[model samples]
Target: MSRVRQILDMNAFDAATGGDGAVKRRLDNLGAASVLFYREPIEMVAARGAWMEARDGTRYLDFYNNVPSVGHSHPEVVAAISAQVARLNTNTRYLVEIVDDYLEALKAKLPVDLSNVVMTCSGSEANDLAIRVARAVSGRHGLIVTDTAYHGNTALVTEASPSALRRSPLPDHVVTVPAPGEAAYGGEDIAGGLRAAVVAAMQTLEARGHGIAAFLADSIFSSDGIFADPAGFLQPAVKTVQAAGGLYIADEVQPGFGRTGDAFWGYERHGLAPDIVTMGKPMGNGFPMAGMAARPEHLAMFCEDVGYFNTFGGNPVAAAAGRAVLRVIAAEGLQENARRVGAHLKAGLAQIAAGSDRVTAVRGAGLFLGVDLGAQDGSGAPDADYTVQVIDRMRDARVLIGAAGQFGATLKVRPPLCLSMAEAERFLEAFAGAVSD
Candidate 1:
């Protein structure tokens, strides 16, 4: 650990949100980092449904983070996990019907060709495994990812991520292309922009004398301003990569499980089939369960060689959680809920943006929306002071929101799939009040 971390530990945040305001001399003496540099702080003690309680007993509506796809501490999901733990909780070596059922149900949500499953502990691990599968199946060594994108913090995925990350470096076999958004050459032709980026990736592979193992993308570009461009653009790119004997790996860590509303997987919107789809974050509704789906042939390669294994992946306990989440998602009709609520939220943001110079634009689909805070002030001169002020104001009004994209100007609103229309209305009302203030 760094000296800064050491200092933080020594100077433990004593108060709930450092409520006591007691600062340790050791921490005061050390250097600063993200934890120490937070501007809007919330001392959360508990959370349920769409609301979270702060240390001071204040209630904050959560309009950010899809990681808990279902509501927090959902009774059904919790019960499923508890029931499984009370029974059997073993590994892959065991003959387990639960594991098989979980994988099977999971397959039902993925592209038909990406049918086989490999469970992991997190999205980063799933992405890592997906890359490994691509490399092994294609006999290629190069990987391509979007610029300004974020896959995970794993060494390889981190390097493949965009420079927005703090400090990530990949090995020689990795290449990058800008995500199709305002920053890249897409100009609204996001799929075409991705295709162009794929061309550059192909060139990169040739230069390395290695075929591309995979072309990995977050279907709608969630980490890069939620860029879900015209649907069919990715097909040509996938074709090109397949021609080069590569696989398309969709990192569905964020937008999977009906986040996009129209489909279970965001890649579906692109009108292309991915050979591999890696999922995590919301799989177990916060239970640290993740997995990847690949065509059976690619899976055979791994089974043939070393034999894939994970101590905790798909353990009976994890399987139960996964099963419950899958059941709830379908039974509750959360996909349709996402569509209705997402549309309402986005429309509200667009309406609020009109006649207001503080917003550059609003874009996204389903339960995932991004509000581009214009740099221009009320007089049309550049001034992000409005955006900054709005975030602080929203926090004060007991709502949680986050920032995204390359410039950090867009306010991200990715609520749980179960968030109701009434909650959407509350969020919009708060946002409007913040803007007006």
Candidate 2:
């Protein structure tokens, strides 16, 4: 079996080997914390719509950044941010109309029962808050996550994110189940198998005296290689957890904001009404903002013990940016666009996979798709090295992409929601050439 790969290590630029003066300067500044893409990182200057311009003036079609879900430098978002900042930019303590307006607009898209929304600076903070609320509401310390899940980078979230851990074993309060897919659960009954795994994980947690507080998962399983098929596969497991007195936290940082096409949120695709829904980055269209939605009672319970406050979580500027993102997504009909263009893109990739042994599996919904690359020797083993080569080749072809999954062989295809059919075809063409070469 291939050794499981760490999330940040996948296709990361190694500063040790060295680079140009700019790269050296960056390493000197950020040191070991610097996470650059590609062995030869591109210095980007500007980006608009689906394409980014390097400092050298080369344009690359972006297919890996979900943070710019609506698009890169969307005029409305930029305008809104500028306009709001020019007028006023204050924290949540001030009763900013834009903040409330944005919250109302956001809540309109969420479950009605999740009445209270607490804004945060990032998904890490949102997830951290969700975990605390879950523990408070359920009175349990244990958490369950997928084997290769990556919730966020905060110490609390990092403890639960197995993919983020390079050396440390999962703490006793955390337990993991295999990702919901054929490779983990077999083809017979994925939903049932996953439910059983969660049940067993809950049992283990209970045995450890840390009864399950939450079953936190990225609804589409993005880092677990983008598993979106068997549509309601998560229902059984989520129900089992809830029945066992555990909250279900839908980490929508990756799959929220109509990226999944069929629904506004990925949890909706699985017919789930999550107890806690955490969203980030894409909510503000690259603006630094994130939020957690929960039942008022649950949030109140958590707050009673310790108050929650963020300096600039739902500030006026962030609210304006978020409002603009929501407006743009609705006005431009990006969700439908995602559904249509994503289907076309997926079909093109599936066609390529059908004809090529190296392209193993294609999965996911909407613009968020994952294509596994395998060895060419007919062994069908996941080839991380070949995946890196394909990524580099795609870069050479002026297309930006990245890798995911436990083996780091799954091409994570998540272009902006505003991706056009022409752009999709361009990516397909680049990808075909890259894999073939």
Candidate 3:
């Protein structure tokens, strides 16, 4: 199926929107490429911390959106953005204290060596810049990404994203490596598997005359079904890439900003220091702000050869928003909250899986959890159709969730970091009911 068609078909969309008018208008304007969530889509007008209020006044516990890391429409983030925008909004051509301050604060949270940053407007831009820099610095054109990984949505990045290329063949310069799934490993070394995959991919790329430029992967493997276990398993892969003269770029757009609870960045969980790190989505809460951090020495070659600059990147307003998100994360101790509430949520999911024959496995760390939905016949095979039903059912119960994995059979339950214990319980209750249904 096409990437856009994999989400919702026309009949389903028509039924969800209650008529053909909204669908027709969208198809007329946005064309057939627009993707929306849920069988019965909710028209959300407003949202707050961990909850979204629809146009009809229905409230839903949001467990899908990580963009609002701190919370939806957070007062502090709003105030910061408002204060900065009202005062001044301009390019990064001139010196700005807030921009430098934000960069310093972000650096403090990252690895000590990743001191240099190049800000962008989105994760796609960040990844694009990272890839460009890696290729320029390494003087190679080959890239390696996970089989079902999704980095972002740009011309260059789309080729790197296997999830977006579902039915299509990847480009010549790109190599797809298998993502490590728990079920795939039978007492095998996880790190070894990752290293082997990278080695094989690099060999293929070299044979194709596209020497390895970079091995880019989301540290959490979000689109490859959220494989975050066996901490430090990615260290071997990082070493393999670096030893082969390829840069290891950590796409932390999904796993950054303390969502993992254990560490600030997902790569930190695996005890691996990436050559370059890209962050977005939750960086400035809802604001459009993202950036790529790298070792100054590694990025210096690219800067000297093909000097880079962005117009709206790291502006005062975005800096203010980013600073607010960092402040809120530290002040509210949301990382601790994710650790506690994520554990509670995972335990509750385990309890539900214990009761249901259809639930095959529960995986992931912190606020990012994936529930494997199995066939109804007790065969334990991935059941994408059944997973879709459960997602729609959860939506009916006013809980927002999503699916991931190659077959889209894993329930992607990554709620906001601020999810409370009560909210986690509520989600568990709803999820248990959905599984039974």
Q: Indicate which candidate wins on lDDT.
A: 2
Whose TM-score is greatest here?
2
State the lDDT of candidate 3 residue by residue for 1-437, as single tens digits.
Answer: 21232323311344334336555566667665656566555678999999999888999999988999999999999999999999999999999899999999999998889999999999999999999999988999999998887888899999998777646688999998888765554447877877888899999999999999999999989887789888888998889899989999999999999998898899999998799999999999999999999989878988888788999999999999999999999999999999889988889999989989999999888999989888988898888888888888888899988888877788888888999999999999899999995
Write down the TM-score for model 3. Answer: 0.95
lDDT of 1 by residue, 44-150 (tens): 78889888897889998887768778888889999988988898888888899989998888887777777778898899889888888888998888888765577
Looking at candidate 3, what is the lDDT of residue 414? 88
Predictions in order: lDDT: 0.77, 0.94, 0.87
Error of 3 at 291 (Å): 0.2
> Model 1 RMSD to the real structure?
5.1
Which residue pairs collide in model 2, if any? none
lDDT of 2: 0.94
Please rank every candidate by lDDT, starting with the best.
2, 3, 1
Which 10-residue window of candidate 1 scores lowest in summed lDDT?
Answer: 1-10
TM per candidate comes to 0.88, 0.99, 0.95
Worst lDDT 10-window in candidate 3:
2-11
- By lDDT, the better pick of 2 and 3 is 2
